[model samples]
Structure formats: C-alpha cells, structure tokens
Target: MTWLIVALVLVVAAAGLLRWRRPAWYWLTFGVTLAALRVLVRYGSVMDACGLTVPAPRWRLTLARMTNRPVPGPRAPRILRFRVTRTGLVLRLKLRPGQDAFDVAASCDRLRHSFAMYGVTSRELRSGVVELRMTGYDVLKRVQMPALAETRPMRVPVALREDGAVHYRDYRAVPHGLVIGATESGKSVYQRNLVAALAPQRVALVGIDCKQGVELFPLARRFSALADNPDTAAELLDALVSHMQDVYQLIRAEQRITADVPDAEIAADIWDLPENLRPVPIVVLVDEVAELALFATKDDEKRRDRIITALARLAQLGRAAGIYLEICGQRFGSELGKGITMLRAQLTGRTAHRVNDEASANMAFGDIAPDAVLAAISIPTDTPGVAITGDSAGGWARIRAPHTTLRQAVNVCNRHADLTPDLPALAPFRPALGTLAPVPAPAVESAPAAA
Candidate 1:
C-alpha cells in the first residue's frame, strides 16, 4: 500500500511537470475523465434534453410516469473506441438506427458545453460511424508535428489537421492549390514548410517571386528556374506552358490504344508512362500572385494577360504533364482582373490563413464551404500558422504548420542543391545562383616590382 501511494504521487508529480513544460501532455493526462464522459453521454438527460435524440412516444412516457420510472428512449450512439492523441481524445461513435451524422454535427457546440471539454468537432467516417474529436485544449496555440520520414513520389506532409492527422499535398490527387493570407499571417511560414518538405525529394522546384525575390531568392540553389520581376515572371510562366505542351506531345507519342496494352497500363498521365521515360516532376511556387496580375500600363497589361493565361493553362492540364502549382498570395479576386476567378476555380485545394478581409476568405473557400470563410477570418492575429483548409468536396478542417524559419528552409534547399534538375528548356530562365550571395572581390597582390 505504501509503494502504491508512492507510485501515485510520482505519477502526479510527473504530470504536473509535463503540464508546465508541454501543455499537449497536460491534455493527454485526462484520459480517465474523457472515458467517463461517455457514461454521462449514455445516461444523462443532456443528449435527450438538447434534442439530440428522437422524441419519445406519449404512451411510453405516460407508462413510465405512472410507475415512477424513467421513460424509455431511443438507443444512444455507442462509443466504440477511444484514440488518445497528442492533441486530444478521439471518440468513435456508432450511430443508432434512424440517426444521421449531421444531427450530431449540428449539436457540436452544445456537445462542447455539456461535456465541459475545450472544443468538439465531428466528421462522418463511414456510412454508420462518426468520429468525435474532443480537444481538451487548443492544439493550435502551439504547433508541433511529428517528423515524417516516409517519402511518396510527388507528395509531402505540410501541416497538421485539427483531428491530429497530418495534412499532405498529393500532386496527383489535388493537382493545384491556392494559399491566401495577409503579410505576416503565416503564409510565408507555410510556404517554407512546403519547400523544406520537398527539398530532398526527387522533384524540380521553380519559383515566381515578384517582390524583388526577397521571398524565394535565399533558396535559389534548389530551384531549377526562378523569376523575380513581372516581366521575367511572364516569360518564365510562358516557358512553363511551352514545356507543358512538349510533355503533352510526349504522352501522345507514348499512348497506344491496343489490346496488347492493358487498360490500366495505358498512358494517360506521366505516371502511366514507363518509369525510365518519365521526366522529373515540377512544382511551381508562386509568391504574391498579385505581383504577377496587377498592371501599370498597356505593356504591363499585355504581360499580365500572358501570365494569367499561362497559370490557367497550367492549373487546367499540368497534372498530366508531371507539373503542379502552389499559388500563394494576399488576395485573389476578380478585382485582380480577368482570369483570376477562372484560375481559382481550377485550384481545387484551398487554404486560407488569417486574412485582412472576409472577401479574401470568400475568394479561397466561398465556392466550397461558406462556413470556412467565417472560420478563416476568426483566426487570431497572434497565431501565425493557423489556417482553414479544404477541397472541392466541401469538406474543411483547421490546420497549422509547424513553425519553420526562413534560415531552416534555406538550409534544406542548399543541402539538396545537387538534386536540382537541369531542363534544357528552362536553362535560359534558371535562377542566378552566382548572384545570390555577392562574391567577395579577389584579393590583390602587388606585381613584385614587375617581376
């Protein structure tokens, strides 16, 4: 008994220390309390009183009242499992008959209040199963993601979803995406995470930064091509379009519609082509797209149109050509002029960080989920990396990228500089690495009296 008491005291001391050092561990120490909440959900009148359950029949209520017994009610959703994660507790619930997942989702706010948990969110897992994520504390207050070692071709884990899952960008699945946020709103940080994640991968990096290359210039070593001004951005994008067309021609030549080639083996995309013949995948990162869109004169107008059209074409057909786009900007609206909306529609994946206006959030998620607009704008200014991310399917989640500094990302790119591929078509527009860091003047030696 004395040993057991000592052990309990040690456990409490350790938990308190962990809470002080890492709040994430503090929330995890409440596993027993989370499990007990399931009983409260099963027997308490909170679920029924809140209209979470179906209404009971009058006859059944009357009979129970006559006998001084509790009224019979519909079967409550069964808690099937508990997954304890660094963020919080995940409860898998099996819905009772005639119950819909939306019913639970709509009552999420009430569920948070009744359970006395910090936050609650729900998502339909399968036909009859729903996952209830009860966050004991706000995970976004401090973002820390587990290191990912697995490397899949053309995919990288970029952020952590609210449900304690890693959010990955699979070029083959989503193809193109748009990131919107104001300056210092974690947009740059998120981009750094992406570049760092992809630095060591066997893919080509191209950049279009029109802000005098302040953003992407530090990572010049890893970029196969880069453009730092409006005029240069226009030419680089046009060149990418030409390269995309050449790849399409290659695919056309490799395609064979014959019985000998299995239907699954037929070449429709770069992935379908034989491994030996496939070109390196390219990811074009556009920093501050507005710099590429806004025009000052007639000459600038023509350049803007060319750039926008090239971007639209890339978003439309670049997926099959082993090309993907990561377009980031402060704002994206029709006000940017022609082709902005069209380009947005083609970018199925949308991520909105703390923006200066609701309109910016709407531009990123209005067509997908209007609620996400509210969520995006609600992000506090203090939180740099919090964002609302979603796809065209109308599903959305809160995500945050682990803090990655500019120097860290630059180091990764420099470490993998040798991996940068050389494409003959892009050679002319390749980034000027020699100028990234100014070369020191050569030391002079006296000519030794003309000897």
Candidate 2:
C-alpha cells in the first residue's frame, strides 16, 4: 500500500511537471483520472435531471403497470467509449431509442456546464451514436500536425483541426476556396504549408502574384505557368479559360452515354473519365486577389474586369474540367468593385486568419457562418498560423498549420520539378523552370558551306 501510494504521488508530480512545461502534455493525463467514471455517472444523472433524456410516455408506463407488466423508467444515453488525444477527449455515447444525436448537439452547452469540462461539441457518428469532443485546452496556440501521408490524389493536408485531426484541401471535394487575412496574419505561412504539401503531388500548378511575384515566385519550380504582372495575369487567365474549354470538349467527346455505363457514372468531373484520357489537373493560386480587382484608369478597369470575369468563370465551371482556384488576399470586400461578390459566392470553402477588421472576416465567412466572423477577427495577432475555416455546410473549426518556411517550400518544389506536367495551352505562360535540360547546340551546316 505504501509503495502504491508513493507511485501515485510520483505519477502526479510527473504530470504536474509536464503540465507546467508543456501544456499540450496535460491533456494526456486525463485518461488515467479515476474521477472519469464518476464524471460519466454524474453526466448521465445531470442529463436526466435536465430533461435531456427521452422519458417513457406516461400512457405506456401506466398501461404496463396496470397489466402487471415490467414498467421501465426513462432511458438515458449510455457511455460507449472515451478516448484522449493531445488536444481533447472524445466521448462516444449510445443514444436511447427515442433520442437522436440532434438532441445531444442542441444541448451541448448545458452538457459542458454539467460535466464541468472545458468546451463540449457534439457530432453524429452513425445512426444512433453521437461523439462529443471535449477540449481541455486551446490547441490552436501551438500547432503540430501529425506527419501526413497523401492517401488520395490531390488531397493536401493544410492544417491541424481543433480535434487533432488533419484538415485537407481536397480539390475533388471543394474545387474553389477563398483565403483572407491581414498582412503578417499567417496567410503567407498557410500558403507556404499548402504549396509544400502540394509540391509532391502529380498535378500542375499555376500562380498569379501581382505583388511582383514576391510570394509565389520562389516556389515557381513546381508551377507550370506563372503571371507576375497585371497584363501578364490577364493573358494567363485568358489562356486558362481556353484550356478549360478544350478540357470540356475532351470530356464531352469521351462521354458517350451507353448501356455499359450507369447514369451515375456518366462523366461530370475529370475523375469520372479514364485516367489515361483525363487531362492534368491545374491549381491556380492567386496571391492578393484584391490586386486583380482594384484598378485606376479605364484600361486598368477593363483589365480588372477581364481578370475577375475569368476567375468567376473558373470558379463556376472549372470543377468538372479539373481546374481549381485558391485565391488569397489581405482583404476581400464589395468595395473592390463589381463581380467581387459573385466571385466570393462561388468559393464554397472559406478560411480566414487574423484579420485587421471584422469586415475582412465577414468577407470570408459572412454568407456561410456569421458566428465564425468574431472568431476569425479575434485570433491573436501573434498567432501566425491560427485560422477559422469553414465549408458550405455551415460548420466551422479553429485550425492551425505548422510553421513551414519559404525556403523549405522552395526546396520541395525544386526537388520535385521533374514531375511538372506538359500543358500546350499554358506553354506560353510557363515560367522558365530549372528542370529542363539545356537545349542541344543547333546543328551546323558544314557540308553546304564547304561546297
């Protein structure tokens, strides 16, 4: 007994030291707490008391008792499993017959208070199962994502979700996305992580950096095409639209509705076609979209209108053509001019880092999740990679990407430069990549000269 007591004391000391040194370590100690069982019971009791449980109808109870049948009391959700991670505890609960996951999700705040846990969020796992994520601490402060293995083609892990899962930028799922952040608000860092993750993939990259290519040029080895100025950007966009049209033509030709193919399997996106016949997917990265939207003179205005229209078209129709857009800017607002709102609406995925104002946050998440606006704007200025990300589903989460330097991203791109694909349409806009071997010296016409 004495030795057991000493061991317990030592374990407590070690946990306390770990908590003091590394806050993330504190989360690991939660699983071993003896109070966990007690807390579960207390949670169940509190849930019943708070009327969260679906009680047996009074008629049924009375009828059963009158017939001398077994009268069952109200049924409460049963604890299925609990697992601890570096950020939080995931508690799975088995719902009663009459109760569903929505009942639990609707009363999550009350559940959090009753359990005395940090933050409690719930999501339906399967039909009758619900998973509750209880975050012990803010995981966004120090982000460290697990090593990513590209499970699916073109799916790049961009950030660590609050629940300690990797969040992916899956072009197949969301073809176009909008990123908004203030200067020095970790937008560049996030893009760096994204580019680094994508450099190794078998996809073509195109960049338009109006900031004199300061942001995207260093990683140009992986980009098949790049545009650094307004005039060049306009031309590049036009070329992409032409390429998109050609791809659509190819898809249409290959798409023959026959008895062999099911209606569901009919070619709608690039993935639906055969691998050999499919064209290379292109990811257009637009750094500082505001640069392309704002103009001064009439010619500039015409140029701006052209760029915006091309971008809007790509967002609307590029998914089926295997063209995706990643537009990043310090600010996105209607003030940029007409078509800005239309373009923003087409981007289904929204990610906003620390912004200078609420208006910038709203520009990213206003139409989807108004609640996330405050969270995006409230991100600490010092937290570089922290962000609020949401999809069209109206769900949002606080995520953070690991710090990836520009040099690292550049190195990755250079190492994989040979993997860059050949696209004839983009050949004119293709950057002078370092992967191409020097052209053989022009053949000399020695015999003719001698004659």
Candidate 3:
C-alpha cells in the first residue's frame, strides 16, 4: 500500500514536470495517457474505451474495414503559417487541390469565434488562402496612426489589442474625421498622439483653437498656422480654401483622364498623382468647434455664419483636394447654426469620445449609425480616449487613442519644425508674438491736488 501511494505521487509529479517543461503536444499526450490508464484501472477494458465491441483479434480487422482508402503519394500537410502584423495578424494557408476556399473560409468562422476569446480570429485573404488575424488585442489598443499614411509605414508600438496583436489603421484613405468628447475626457491626448505621429511626415498642419490656443499653441512650431479666435479661424479657413483651390488646379493640370489609364491611375488628388508631382497633404485640426458656432450679438451672428459656411465648403470640397479636417468639439448639433447639419453631412468619418451631453453623441453618429450613438452615450468618463470610429466605407471600429502628453507632442512638433510649410493666406492670422508694439500706457490724472 505504501509503494502504491509512492507510485501515484511519482506519476503526478512526473505529469507536472512534463506540463511545465514541454510544449502543448506533450501535455496532450500526457492527458491521453492518463485517460488510458484510468480506463484500464477502472474498467479493466481497453476495447470498451476505444468504442470497440468486437473480440480483440477481430477488432483491428473491423476498424480496417470501416476506414476509407488513402490518397495518392506525397500527401500534403494541413497546416497554416501566420505572423502578427501591426494592423493585424497575417495567416498564410494553402488549399488542397480541388478544395474550395470559400467553404474553408465559412468553416473557419467557428474557429474564429473560438479564438476570439483569446483575441485571435481567422479571415479570408484570397481564394484558396486565409489569414488568422487578431480581432481585438489588448496591448496595442491606444496608439493613434497618422492621417497621411505611407505604404509599409513603420509601426509605432503600444499596448496590444484584447487578442494580443498590434492595433493600427491607415488614416490617409479615411480622409476627414470628427472627434467629439466632453471636457477632460482624454480627447486632447488622442489629438496629441495623432499630431506626434504626423509630425515626421511631409504634411501641412493647421490648428484652430478657440480656447485661446491653449490646447495647440504649444505645438505651434509644427503648425503652419494657428488660430486662437473665431475671426482668426475664419481667416485660416479662407486661406486653406485658397490652398485647396491651388491644389485642385495642380491636379487638373496633371489630370490623365484617358481610356488607357484607369480611374485609379488618374491624377485626381495629391495621392493619386505621380510621385514626382504629388504635393504633401494638409491636415486641419479644430479644437472646441462650438466656439465657432456660438454668437452673443448680431455682429457675432454674421461672423459665425461666414465661419460655418467656410467650414462647410472645406468639408465638401477639400477631401479630393488633399485637405482633410479633424474637427473636435464638446457638442456639434444642427441646432448650433444654419449650416451645422450641412457641414456634418460632408464629414463621412466620425469618432465620438466620452461626451457630457447626449446631443453631442447624437451629432457625432446619429445620421449614420444609430447604434453608434448608443455606444457613444454609454462611454464612461473614466475611459476618456475610448471612441467609436466610423469611416466612409461603412465600417466602424472601437478604438482607444494612447495617452500622449502635451509636452511630448510639443517637443515632437518643435523637432520637426523644418517640415512646416508656408501658407501665405494663413500668415496674417498667425498669433502675434510679444515683438508686436505694446499699447501706450494710459495717462493717470493727479488726485486733483489731494481733493
């Protein structure tokens, strides 16, 4: 009895050691061996465990009779190879000859669901092939990509998604985007990440900060122009409009609308143009857009109208002209002004962070996806940068931009100052430095000879 106990203890210790040191295959083998031993010890029957009822001698013969014939020589292995990429994991699987890829893909959906619990999934890449991509990993979830993306761009690492894979997207093709969030809801951090990512690229940065440029002024070295007031914002938008017109002219001049050249090849925008002729793209960032819509008097009303009109124009025509808008605000609704809804209509890309008001959440996604509105409103203040992002392609994704410091963004911008472009029209609206002449001190009257 003591020897039996010792033997059982040794078996458990051996199993533990194998489990700790060996790969998954060894653990599976150990489990199968243990199950076999249990069956033998408890039932004293190997045939019963194998689901065999025939006598031992005839059991092998019966199994052979039930099995089908083998295939031709050099049978291929059924396995797929994959690697985790920045956007997602990439799987490469070769299909068996005469096998349907679609059937395999449909079958993989169940596998994808099973893997989703661990942040992994399978997606069909092409016929006769597939990729095991990460659906939502947790580690790289909060990084923000640049607006003007490049082919095979270097990925900026952050935390992984819930699935344990990198998280990223190409924003250049996404064009314009709206970021709506309540105050202190981490929207600014996301913006900082976005700016830092784009600073190294050869692109124009424009900022409209109605909060006395509090949010964007620190990064002025990277911005071609920064507007602090509504009037200044108007001037900046006008200048951008002029720049858009120039870019449009350039595209038209280089337009290659021909039967031989496909629409994809036509030089319609900066991206579509030939590399040598393509000019850098421009990204316009607007902070607290509500200020541009607010008015206290009749004069303010007229100014708001012009400002909204210019924004609407930019939203309408600037996309194809290589100018994109990243408009952020606490609230953006049709009730804000006459052209507010009109402008919203043109902003195909939408992102809503945690918002204080349901109206703001509604403005961000109500027109497009009603479900997204619910998601936006449900976001808690504690998770600031978490947002629902919808693109023009009708696909929506939940993303959390990384927490980027204002000082880090400013430093990045300053380091990349040489790339900043000169926008002649916007130059006048730039914040004046202290070098400007000081106002004359008001003359103080004597105390009327001590009364």
Candidate 4:
C-alpha cells in the first residue's frame, strides 16, 4: 500500500510538471487516459442530468416489480465505441428510441463540463449514430503544427484545426477564398505560413499588395508577378484574364477528338491536357483587397471596376484555367463598391480571423454559416491567430495558424526561388528582388530557366 501511494504521488508530480512545461506530452501520457476513464464513468449520470436520457420503458418497470427487483435506470445513449485520441476521447453512441443526435448536440456544453473536457462537438454519422469529439484540453491555446506529408498540389496545411486535425488551405477544393481580419489579427502571419507552404511547390504565385508591396515584397523571389499600386494591379489582372483565355484556347486546340483517343486523354481544362503541355497553375494572393476596392475619384472608380470585374471573372472562370485567388482584407462589404459583393460571391472558401466587429464577421460567413459568424466575432483578442474557416458546403471549424515570421517565409521563398514559373503574360509585372537583403541577385540569375 505504501509503495502504491508513493507511485501515485510520483505520477501526480510528473503530471503537474508536464502540464506546465509540456502540454502535449502531458496530454499523451496522463490526460488522455484519465479523461477517457472519467468520461466512461460519468457518461450515464451526465446524460441523465443534462436531460439527454429517455425515460425507462414501462415494460421494464413491470418486469422488475414482478421479479421483486429494483427498476432499471433511464436509458442513456448506448456507447458503441469509446476511443482515445492524442487530443481527447471520441465516443460513438447509438441513440435510444426516444433520442436523436440533436439532443446530444444541444447538451454538448453540459456534457463537456460534466466530463471535465475542454471542448465537445457532435456530428451524426448516420441516422442513428452520433460521434462525440470531446477534447481533453484547449488544443488551440498553443499552436503546434505536425509535420505535413506530401499533400495534393496546391493544397497546403496552413493551420491547426480545433479538433487536432490540420486545417489545409486546398486551392483545388476551395478554388477562391476570402480572408477577413482587422489590424493585428494575425492575418498577416497566416498569409506568411501559406506562402511558406506553397513556396516548395511547382506553382506560379502572384501578389497584389497595394500597400506599396510592404507585405509581399519581402518574399518576392517565389512570385511570378506582383503589383504594388492600383494602376499596376489593374494591368496585372487584365494580363491574367488574357492568360486565362489563352489557356482555354490551348485546351480547345488540344481536344483532338479522334475516335481512337480515350475519353480520359481528351483535354478540357489544363489538368486534362497532356502533362508536358499543362501550364503551371497560378495562386494569386491579394494583400488588403480593400486597398484595391476603395475609390474616391472617377478614375479610381473606373480602375476599381476593372479590378473587381477581372477578379469576378477569375473567381468564376479561373478554376478551369489553373488560376486561384486568395483575397485578404479587413472588411469586404458591399459598401466597398458595386462589383465587390459579386466578386465575393464567387469565393467559395471563407476564413475570418479576429475582426473588430460582428459586421465584418457577417460579411465573411453571413450567407454561408451564421453560427460561424458568432464564432468569428467571439474570437478573443488575446488569441491572435485563432479564426473560423468554412466553405460553401456550410461546415465550419475553428483554426489557428502557427506564428510564422516574415524572415522564415522569406527563406522558404528564396530556397524555392527556382520553382517560380515564368509566364509570358505576367513577365512585365514580375517583382525584381535583386535588392532584397537575404538573397543575392547573381545566385537567382544562375538558376536553371523554366521551360
């Protein structure tokens, strides 16, 4: 008994130390098991207290009385499986006859508190099965991104999801995305992480930083084209539109519809074409879209219209032409301009960081997911990078990007500088990074040319 007590004391001490010094380690060693046990033990009582249990069947009571035995307790959802994950416990439950998934979802908060878990969320797997993901701790409090494997091209792991999964910025799946956040909202750092993730891939990057290239110029080595002002941005968008049209023309010409040609070999978009003929895809990052949207004079208005029209066109038609848009701004309301709302409608993916107001949150997730707006607005200012990410599919999750500095991103950009594809359409606006402090111009010039 004395030996067991001493071992328990040692375990407690280790748990305390690890909880303070290394949360992830503590979670793996002690937190997961203890949380799982607590959840299993308290499952029935917690469900009953939270009104998630159905009343005992009258037949059971009648049988118990006839047998002169105690009546069975109310029926709680049957736990089909209880599994331990790195972050928490996942419980798969089979609903009782009178219960449904909604009952469990609505009682998640009570269940979370009863189980002493940090977070609880539920999703119905089928008509009768619901999965409860109960996080043992606040996963987003301290961001630690796991090493990413070889993901699909144009797909980059940008942040950690609340459920301990990687939140990927998949350009192919989302196509065009809108990111909204106020000043000091960690939006810039998120963008930096995204840039770093994409630098190693064989994709063309284009930046339109109307803030005189303050945000994107530092990592210009990986960019095929960059525009720092409204005028240049307008010209750049026109060039992109032209390039997209050129790609479509190429696809049309490549549609060699011979009877012998396999349907899979027939070209439609750039991906469908022969690998040798397929052009490098483009990922356009717009820093501070409001800078390009706000206009005071008629000339500025005309330029803004042209930019918006071009962006709308790309968002609508660029998916087939191997072009994607990542537009970031503080606010993206209809007040920005007439075509602004239409352009926003084309962006299927929406990510909102810590915004200054609920209105800004609404602009991002309003029509898509109303609950996400609340989550976006409620983002504590103390937690900088935490944001809500959702798509047109109407699902949203909280995510926080690892803090990445400008210098780190610049290094990745310079290391993969050779991968920058030279598109003839964007050559005129290509940013000259010769003067950047980190990389030498001669080394950049010495790299082998792209085909």
Candidate 5:
C-alpha cells in the first residue's frame, strides 16, 4: 500500500512538471495519456474523483447535418458558414427565412468574450454567421509579422484613417483642407485627386490659379470661375464672399420665421435652403497663393495688401458660411509678409508634401506638430505624392495621393462649369481687360484700315 501511494504521488508530480515546462500540445498529450492510465488502474475510483463523463458531440453532428440539407430551387441556405483567415477571418452565413446580417452581429459580443477564455476569438461574418480565429499566446509577436495583404482602396495604409469616404473624418465633416508643397513635390496631384473625388458631388468648384491660368485653365469647364492672376483672383474671391453673405442671409431669414416644419425641413445650411435661395457650397482652390501676396513695385503693394486682407477674412469666416478654402502654395511662412501667418492659423487641416526648404515645412506644420515638419522634409523627392497631414484635433497621418495628371483635373473642372456670377464689391478691382489686350490690336485698329 505504501509503495502504491509513493508511485501515484510521483506520477502526479511528473504530470505537473510536464505541463509547466513543455508546449501546450505536449502537455495535452501527456495529460491525456496519464489520465487514461490512472483511469485503467484505479477504475471506478478514478472516474468518481475526476467526475469524468463523456457526452456525444452534438454541435459537430448538427453542423454536419446542416451541411447536407438540400437546397430548394433558387433559395439560399438557412445556415451560415465561416472559415478563419490569416489576416482576420471570413464568414459565410445563410440567413434564416426572416433574419438578416445585423441579427448575427448583435450577438457577436457575447460569443467573442466566451471564446476568449480558450485563446480564440469570434466576430460576426455577417448577419447569419460568425468566424473563429485562434489567438496565439504570444499575440503581440504575431502582430509584428510582415503584412502580406496588398493595399486596396478600402484599406488605409497608415495607422490613421483616410479611406476617402464622405464620413465624419472626410469631406462631409471637414469640408476643406489646405495643402502646402514646393515645386516638383506633387501638390498638384493631391489637389487633382481631391477635386476629382469632390467634383461628382453637388458642390460648386472655384479656382484661383495665379500661374497665368496654365495649371488650372484646362479645368475651366468645371470651375464656375478661374482667376489667372491676383487681380482676377481678388475679383473671384469677392464674388464668392458676396455669395456667402447671401447664403447667411438666407439662413437668418429661415431662423426668424418658424413654421410647423419637420426637423428635416429646417434649413441648416446652403444645401438645405429653398431652391430659389439655395446657393451651392463652393470649394475654392487657390494655387500659388504666394502670387496673391507678391508685389512687383510699391505702387502695386496696396493691391497685394487688399488681396491678403480679403483672403484672411474668407479663411476666418468662410467655413461656417459654407464657402471653404483649399489653399495650396510652394511657401507659406512669415517671410511671405504680414498676413501670411494669420492666414495659416485659420487653416485647421494641413497637408505638407515634400518641401524645398525646412522653413516651408515648418510653416505648414510648425504650430501643430514640429516633428511632422521633419518628416515632411525627409520625404524623398521621388515620392512626390506622399505627404504628412495634420488636423485641428492634433492628430497626424501619412498619406499618398494617387497620381493624377493635369488633363484629368482639367476634365473634372470642365464637367462642373456653371454660369459665373458678378460681384459688385469687386468691380473696382477687376483688372482692365483693355490693358491686357494685344498691343498691336489696339494700336493698329485705332490707326484705321488702309483701304
């Protein structure tokens, strides 16, 4: 009897040691074997001690039976099926006669938590089924594995999200953003992508390209107005401001006269105004913003000052009025002159592409994230479309705008063109078209035809 007791103790100690020192699979094998041996030797005593009992695996049998169910005509199956996947998991569930995917997702939380005890996780594949994925003990190490999946439009490359969806984080929420990049740094491509995406919507497009209309003229077909120089830009902006004022007045008029209108019937913005009073939301794109600041002589300095003051006012008040700015520039620093820094402060969203100088990058991301300036400067010249973006929330992200060409942007603009409106406030600032006329046209024509 004494020898038998000692042998039992030794066996129990060995089993515990194996479990502690070996892998889970090895421990499972050893434990099952030892338990089997104990059951054979001790018979009924061992069974009673462990309270061991075996029940038929009903779940496995039920699954098998469900799989064999015959399909009736073109109708779908009733049971959902799913398989675990490498990156995440895949699920395929057949909906019940009246059930949908949302039903399955509703119960996923409980299922996930229950499976967590076994180092397994489950998520709703859809309304009908769920997927179970094994989580290794060393889960953190597994996460570091090189990503094998290819980047798709639905996938965000950075840790932050920029999937181009018109959700809270995207166009529907922010409405506008300012992008700063030097020449050859791919700012134009980013602008092109943004315009291409937004053009399909009902928003009106406005462009101020001080590059002699070379960069944006092709897109004139879509743009309500395209200003080629500072003088024209000032006029175009003043028109937009007048348009904004009208929108505000409309809002105020609606607020004052309360009707038995439904919640949805209330006019909240330009989009919700009555058809007659509805002004389309304008997305103003400014290219080479520095041109709006540069002055060749002291005589022209006053004109530049007026332009700056107008832009600053727009940047400060336009957002709530539904006239948003998307200002692009090669440089946007204090060196640009007095109002430049003030203008930068009004731009809540910042995207800095590869810059020619650190100072330009600092101008874009300095007050927000100084480290992001370093990252922007380090971006390789070859990677023109890649940029560092920061928002008013102080969150930063890296994004690469898909390549876009000048022609594509022009085509987008041409498609959205509408009859331009005149701004009376800007009448004095409008550049004299006569002064821009060909020198020979005025001189020769005025001399009279030599018939």
Candidate 6:
C-alpha cells in the first residue's frame, strides 16, 4: 500500500514537470483525458454559470406544471460533437432557440476560464450550429509548423496560428500587406521566412532595402532585382510599373473576347493566360518604407514624392498584373509624410509585432478591431516573432513565424537560384555577384618578427 502511494506521488510530480517544460507531451500523455473528463462532467453547470443558457420555453413550463413535474430552469446549447485535437478540443454545438453564435463568441473568455482551457474561439458553421475551438496550451510559446500538406498556388505557410493552425501568406487572397514592428521585434525574421518560402517557386523577387544593402542583399541570388538605396528603388519601381503595363497589354492581346469564345478563355489576369505565355509573378519586398518617405532637401522631397506615388500606383493596380507588395516598417503613419496613409489603405493585410507604442499598433491595424491593437502593444519583449494578423474584412488572430536564421534562409535561396525569373525591364538593377574580392590579409612588421 505504501508503494502504491509512492508511485502515485511520482506520477503526479512527473506530470507537473511535463506540464511546465514539455506541455505538448504532457497534453498528449495526461491532459487530454483529464480535460475531456472535466468538460463532460461540468459542461452544463459551467455553461449555466457563464450565462450561456436560455430560459425554458413557456409550453415546456406549462406541460411540466400540468404533469406535476419539476419546472425546467434553463437549456444550454446541445453538444452535437466533441473532437480532440493535438492542440485542444473542438465542440460543435446546436444553439438554443434564443441563443446565437455571437453570444458564444462574446463570452469566449468566460468559457475559456470555466473550461480551464488556454484559449477559445468560435465561428458559426451553419444556421443553428457553431464550432468552438479550445486550445489546451499556448501553441505560440514554441512554434512548430504542422506536417506538410498540399498548398494552393501563390500561398506560403509562414507562421503557426495560436489555435495550432497554419497561417498562410496568400498573395492571391491579399495582394498587398503591411508588416510593422519595433527594432529587434523579429520583423526581419518574418521577412526572411517569406523570402525562403518564395525562393523555390517560379517567381521573381524584387527587394528595395534602403539600409545600404544589409537586410535583403544576402538572399540576392534568388532576387531578379535588388535596390540598396532610395534612388535605385525609385528606378526599380518605375521599371516594375512599366512591366505591369506590359503584362496588362499581353492580357489584352490574349483576352480572346470574340463572341464565340468561352468566358473562361477570355483572359483577365496573368493566371488566366496560357501557362507557357504567362509571365512569372513578382513579390516586391520593401525593407523600410520610412527610408523612402523621409526627405530633407528639395531634391529629396521630390524623390520621396516620386517613390510614394510609384508605390501607391503599384498597390492599386499591381495585383491584376501578377505584382504584389510587401511593405515592412517599424511604424507606418502620417509622420512618414504625405501619401503614406493612402498607401496603407491599399494594403489590406495587416500584421503587427511588438511595437514601441500603441499608436504604431493602431497604424498597423487601422481597419481592424481596437482589441487587435491592444494585443499588438501588449506583446512582451521576450517573445519576438509573435504578431497579430488581421485584414480589412475583420477579425484577427495571434501568430508566430517559425524562426529562420540568416544562414538557413541564404541556403534556401542558393538552393533554388535556378528558379529566379528574368525580368528584362529590371535587369539593370539585378544584384552583381562575385564582384568584390576578399580583403587581403594585413602584413606583419619585419622588425616585430625579428624581435
């Protein structure tokens, strides 16, 4: 009997340690069963306490009274199905007559606390049914991307969502994106992940890094064009604008708009063009938008206006021409100067990492909920890559990009250098490789050697 007690104590101690250090293992070994039991036993009472219950109907009350039966107090949503996932549980519920998905979503925090879950999110699956996803632990604490699966064209899985789902950077869905974070906020790491993801694909990468070629130049092998200064970036932008016009002209020529032609054959965008004839898509990465916007002299002011205007035009029309913009910065606001807000408006996808102030978060999530801004600013210094991702449509989620070191990203780019596309208009800006020789070793003094 004493041995049995000792074994029980040991098991509990190990579980506690696992829960602290290896949450995923702990969840798989013990947490799942215990969580399931908790939900099954206390669901009804917990729902009632959380006010997620509807009063019994009048007819039911009348029938109970007539039959001399106890009165029904309230009705909680019926659980249609309960599913256990690696990260947490999914509960599909049938809403009570008076209840809707909104109520459940509104009370997610209460539900999360009552169920002892890490996080809870809800979405309506159908008219009367809603799906509640509960996370067993903080998935973002240690980012591990899920197993590879078939992905769609122009989509790259860049991060892990808080709910254990993959967060994809889908260019087709969001043609332009704005990424903002303070220094050492893992903004550069996120960009490296993006570049690595797109390296193997048949696409052209255009980099505008105004930091003296520090950030984006390392992965130059896979980039069709790279500009290390604002002047070159302006020229590159003009070249891209011209390339877009050329693509549009090609699409017009291939429209096949005759009355007898099928509507599907009437090409609109590059995707609709014949595979052999279609030009490769281009992803423009602007390392620091503020660099291009800041100006001191009259010449600098003219240059800044030109650059902003070119960027705005690209954001407005580049989508249909297979050109996408990824604008990254520490802060995106009117302080950068005129036309900044207009460009921000055109970027539908917003991602904010740890920012220095609330105003920076607001600049990133201008069209999203205020809560998103709050979440962005609240990110602690220890967590670097954690960010809030949202879009102009609405809603937001926390995501953390898998860490990709500079060397790893460079290796990836080198591995797929053959996939780099040739864009004639921007060929002048193509990064020159093997142009600089290693610095010669300094010679030792003969007198010092003799001594």
lDDT (tens digit, per residue) of candidate 4 on 91-124: 8999988787888889988888899888898989
Report the Cα lDDT for residue 161, model 2: 80
Candidate 1 per-residue lDDT over residues 199-224, each given as its tens digit: 88989999999888899989999999
Assess each prediction's global lDDT (C-alpha) against the native.
Answer: 0.86, 0.85, 0.68, 0.90, 0.60, 0.92
Off by over 4 Å in 1: 1-17, 29-46, 54-73, 148-151, 435-451
On lDDT, who's better, 1 or 4? 4
Q: Estimate the TM-score of every prediction.
A: 0.87, 0.87, 0.67, 0.88, 0.56, 0.93
Q: Evaluate model 3: give its lDDT.
A: 0.68
Q: How much is the lDDT of residue 339 in candidate 1? A: 95
For lDDT, the strongest prediction is 6
Residues 26-131 of candidate 6: C-alpha lDDT, one tens digit per residue: 9999999999998889999989998899999999999999999999989899999999988889899999898878889999999888889999999899999999
On the 0 to 100 scale, the lDDT of residue 295 in model 6 is 94
Error of 1 at 412 (Å): 1.3
Candidate 6: deviation at residue 2, Å?
4.3
In candidate 6, position 120 carries an lDDT of: 91
Q: Residue 121 in candidate 3 has what lDDT?
A: 44
- RMSD to the hidden true structure, all candidates: 6.0, 9.4, 11.5, 7.4, 19.4, 3.0
Which candidate number maximizes TM-score?
6
Q: What's the C-alpha lDDT at position 231 in model 6? A: 92
Candidate 6's clash total is 0
lDDT order, best first, reads 6, 4, 1, 2, 3, 5
lDDT score, candidate 4: 0.90
Q: Model 5, 89-199: lDDT tens per residue? A: 233445434445444444444433433212333345555554434321222211222244233221112211122211122543565567888788878877777666666
